[model samples]
Target: MTLLESIKEPQDLRTLSPPEVGELAAEIRTFLVRAVTRTGGHLGPNLGVVELTIALHRVFDSPVDHILWDTGHQSYVHKLLTGRQDFSGLRGKGGLSGYPSRAESAHDVIENSHASTVLGWADGLAKADEVLGRRRHLVAVIGDGALTGGMAWEALNNIAAAGNRPLIIVVNDNERSYAPTIGGLAEHLATLRTTDGYERFLTWGKGVLQQTPVIGQPLYGSLHGAKKGFKDTFAPQGMFEDLGLKYLGPVDGHDTAAVESALHRAKRFHGPVLVHCITEKGRGCLPALADDADRFHTVGRMNPLTCEPLVVPAAASWTSVFGDEMAEIGAERPDVVAITAAMLQPVGLTRFAEEFPDRIWDVGIAEQHAAVSAAGLATGGLHPVVAVYATFLNRAFDQVLMDVALHGCGVTFVLDRAGVTGVDGPSHNGVWDMSVLQVVPGLRIAAPRDADRLREELREAVDVDDAPTVIRFPKEPVGEPIPAVGTIGGMDVLHRAPDPDVLLVAVGALAPLCLQTADLLAGAGIRCTVVDPRWVKPLDEQLPVLAAQHGLVAVVEDNSRAGGVGWAVGQALRDAGVDVPLRSFGVPERFLAHAGRGDVLAEIGLTPVEIAGRVSAVLERRAAAGERIRPKENGA
Candidate 1:
């Protein structure tokens, strides 16, 4: 068996020789390229961390050590080393998850896929251990890009002042988070990155001085004590050391021996410590290294040798449509500026950035800062558009409300992956945006059904210059534009059945699903009308009026059932004194498991079959009374 297959647990790595560790790292990289390419998972991040992970496992005993991975995308190697080598179905049904899973192993802690949270987790774990009088080691492995987040600094401030709290923070400095690290933190880390020469000098000094007997030992001790002076002269990692935590490294992350030695030193320290390691992302893979864009950060199923995609999307993605339209918008409106939380390309702002270089801001991974800064830009006389993933925007809700909405700043938030993003698991899903943002007073929200509505509503969102506006769309491809049959007081009538008993309210990407649901309900002898309310919040004034004509009204959205569009529409009906029997269909109030989008929808009863059956059952129950609730003849 190869070195990789010979071990089933992290303990197996402890006994490996230097040559063996090198061989194992090579084997892990080869295995990763082969396995991850077959199943389409994070290729570059895992490739970058093979040696680092091996060194971590070897230098510290896991499970007992409480080693944590920030963002967790680079934990695939950790999984393999911890005995989860079966990667055949990664990110698929009943398969290994893309990130760390607590259910999968005792070795994994903190299943967070969001960036810059590992330090906080480590701090908490260290405090708990101290309170309980336990002697467990806590190691938080964070990416260099993640350090840009304010939360990380907050945790660092606490971790630094914890006085004798034994915590080790490993900054996995490969210098990229989907894109190159941004902001002042990236610049600071770059300065520290040039201090590799200091480490080399110290290594040479320790070897030469320690050989001179008693005086040599004293001299070496004196030299090591003056290490901070050397660091200050060579670099300014004093930012970390001044915070009160011991700082080590500028170690080569690819050099397993160097990393293990640094980790061993960190383990011996009495207080919290930081070890900075320099590594290359996509280290072993030629194609991954050659490709500058994200270093193949996340890859689809592909041929490992040729690096060719096995499957290609048949249509343009919603992200690309938004990107293209934003370029046109930028050209037309010179005052319109764009902002994203370090995800320039992912959130469909690439074209806007390329077209208007000075007008775009990559605000690192700080969404809260992005919102507040957008507010500032708006107050300064320019219309700012903040584009981010719907899930990530949750972090900046307070800023959006207090800074933007309260001050009447005209900042538009474009949320990509706005609903039920499947396969990446619960943390990545964008289902909570509608429910959470429902409480943001005066913040108008638009849910576009297709490419046409997306472009139209996006323009409309940017036009509002007095209050915060949001445009949310899903991760799926742009289908053929669904033209409205007619318009009813700001809502689009997709299908209208004569003398309808039920009105189906479609939101955003679920418009097509509502149309299909209408077809099924017709077969069941239930006449229906389907309408798409493009703007969900401050819903069309005619919605309650229309509800008064139907025996039953159902609001369907690809968001959480709790506090979602259904709840908003129900409140509208109640206030209008319509008293219509309302049914709300959406994602259940639970964290959905990873699966295909269609599969998850079916599981959550969002499909046409499920809705029709439930609606039919409700109608049958009311029919037993020889009447539908508050029935209106001819929908009047």
Candidate 2:
């Protein structure tokens, strides 16, 4: 059998000879390249961690000894080692998730795809183990770049305050995160970059001291201690040491023996120990290494024959629309600026960066910092658009609420991937933005139904000066437009029957699906009226008024069913005492696993056929209760 086929678990790896283990690393790398290339998933991050993964699995007993991968993107190699070699369906509809999934394996301790969160998890797990009197070791493998996040420091502080637990905080210093890690940590690491190499030179300097005479032994010992002190004084990581955790390494991460050796030493230490292992980001992949930015962070599906990446659609994505319009907005108004939390290209701010280099800022995975800084910019009488991924924005909720909204700063928060995002898995899904952002005081939230509205709303968001405003959109390109049949307040009536039995209120991208449902219901002689509420939050004042005229009002949204636009509309009708019965159609209030966007939507009963059937059933129930169908206020 092949090397990969011979292994079914981590125990199988421990049995292999060192040479065989090295060969197995090679095999794993090859498998990852081919598998991820075919699936269009994270490739470079996994390629860089093959040997590190081998060392981790070999040294620690996982499932018993917890292994937490901070960002989870680099855990692809971990998945391969943990007996999950089924890449045939990786990141597809029912395939293996791109990130770690607890449902997939017990070895994965946390489903963390967000950056700078592993350290905090390690601290908590280690503490819990202590409280439960469990002997299992808690190990958190965090990227060096992730240290730039403020949350990591908070975790580090707590870890230090808790003193030594059998927690191994491995800093996988890959020298990069998307774009060469920014801020103070990067500079400190740069100092160690030369200092580590100079250790060999320190050995040469030891020779010089040895030649100094009979007193050289004691003198050399004292001088060696002095040299270490000197290094620490100049490049002091006293921040970690002061917290009471043992600091180890600056070791070569590519050397499996060195990594394994350091881990073994850390296991013996009584307190929390940080083992800093330096490795390359795209170690085995030449093409990825040569790429100047992000090292091909995440890839997309491509044409098999032409070898061309498949475009989402011809019309620009909501992200690109925001990017293109923001560029013009920035040019037109000198006060306008753009910000992203280490997601410059993914959020489509690359062109914005290029056009307005002075106005754009990449905050290095610190979403909290990005949000507060945008608030500061707003306070200074400048317009700051904080464009971040829908999921990552969760990290900065407090900052958005307190610093931006509570303070009443006019910061424009643009969320890309505001609904279900496929392939990247549950941790990366943008489903909770609307639900989470609802509590922010004086925040105006808008959802664009198509590309044109995305452009216009983004412009309006930047221009709005009363309070903080958020404009969110999905991952895919804006498809076909749903032209309004009529306009009332912020809601646009897309399809209205002269005598309406049901009202279909579509929020954002769900308008097209609403139109399809209307067509289906028309065939069934249900006479449905569909409206797109462009602005979801201050909920189109006319929605309750419109709901009062119908027997049944069905609200369709792509967000969580609880606390979504649909729920808001229902509450509005309740407050107004409209008495018209309503039904809400949206994603369920549960974590969704990795699946295609359409597949996920259908499963949640958000599809056109499902919505139509559901609406018809509700209308039938209302009719059974003796409610009569009503005519439109403005006759359709």
Candidate 3:
């Protein structure tokens, strides 16, 4: 067996020789490229951290040391070292999670996949350790990309204030999060990366000043007193040092010995220490290294040799449709600008960026900054469209409510993965946007059912000169257009029965499922009229009237059942004095595991067959009660 196969636990790495450790690194990279190509996960991030992870495992005792990973996508190598190397069914139902899971192992902590949260976790853990008088070391492995977040800085400030606290913060500077990291932090890191000569000169100067005559000792003390200014004049390593933390190397992250040495030194230090390790995002695997876009950061199943996707391409996704339309919109409106939270291409702003370079801004992995900045942009007489994944929008809820909605700024939020993003697991699924954004007063949310509506609603959202507007769509392909046969107060009447018994309210991409359920109901002699509420938030004024004519009103959506469109519709009916019994069909209010979207939806009873069966049961019960059916009303 090879060095990798021989190792089952992190302790086993301690037995390996220098040459064997190097061999293990090679074997791990080769295994990652093959296994990840088949399983489809965070390949580039893991590949980048092979040597760094190996060094961490070799240097620290893990469970005892409390090593935490920020944005746990880079923890695959950590997983492998901790004896969870089985790659089959990765990110599938009942399989290994894509991110760190506390349930998976004792070694795993902080399962949250959101970026820039590890520092806070480390601070808390370190504080607890100190309070309890535990000798365990607290090591937080963070990325340079994650440092852009305000939370990371907040944690850093707290960590710095506790001067006697033992905390080792290893900054894995790979220079990218989803895309290349942006903002002032990236530029600051870039300066740190290039100032090696200055660092060397400063070290020599410090030693020389300390070794000189009586005047030299006093001069050295004076320089140490004003170290921040001295470093600023010479090396500028004062960023972390000024924060009352010990600063270590710009160590080559790929060199195992160098990284291990730096980590060892930090561990020995009895106070807060920052170890800056420079590494490439896609260090190994030529194809990943060659990838200009995102460095193959995250990928689907692909050929290991060619790095080309093995699966067949589906129809254009909702993101591409929005992207194309945004580019067109940008060409027409000079004041139309775009903002992204470090995801330019993924959210479909690449074309828009290319067309209007100066108009587009990448705010790093800081969603809070992105939302607040969009508010500023809107205030500056520009209609700012912030494009980001639906799940990530949860991070900026306060900013969205206070900065955008409160000010009534015309900031359009385009949420790409709006519902049930299955493979990436619980933290990634975009099922909470509708439920969470419901309480934001004056905020209009549009759930586009198809590509055409996505294009149309996007234009409509931007046209709103006051109040925040959100246009959200799912992760799946934008399938065949489901054209509306009629319109009633901005609602699309997809399928209308002459004498309707049930009013099927379809929210966004759930239109197809709603239509299928309607057909099943029709087959069972239950006449159903299906309507797609394009704008789910601020329910159409005519919805209660339309539902009042039907015997039952069933609302179906892909978001959480609690506080979703169904709940909102039910409230509308109750307020309007419509006594129609309502049933809601949606995802359960629980964390959904990793699986295909269809499988998860089916499991949660969001499928047509399940919905149809429930509706049929409800109708049967109503008939048994001998309730009189209401006649259909024509006017909206």
Pick the TM-score winner. 1
Q: For candidate 1, report its TM-score.
A: 0.96
**Candidate 3 residues 1-636, lDDT tens each?**
778888898999999889998999999999999999998999999999999999999999988888899989999999899999898878988889889888899999789788899999989988888889889888899999899988999999999999899999999998988888888878878878886776566678689998998888888778667766755665566878989989987899999999999999998899999999998887778888888788889999999999999986679988889999999999999999999988899999999999899999998888999999999999999999999999999999999999999999999999988899998899989999999999999999999999899999999999998999999999899999999999999899999987788999999999998999999988998888999989999999999999988988999998999999999999999999998999999989899988888878988999889999998898788779886665446322
lDDT of 1 by residue, 459-517 (tens): 99989999999999988887879999999999999999888989999999999999989
TM-score of 2: 0.95
Regions more than 4 Å wrong, model 3: 198-230, 629-636
In model 2, which range of ten residues has the least summed lDDT? 302-311
Whole-model Cα lDDT of every candidate shown, in order? 0.91, 0.83, 0.90
Model 1 bad stretches (over 4 Å): 202-227
TM-score of 3: 0.96
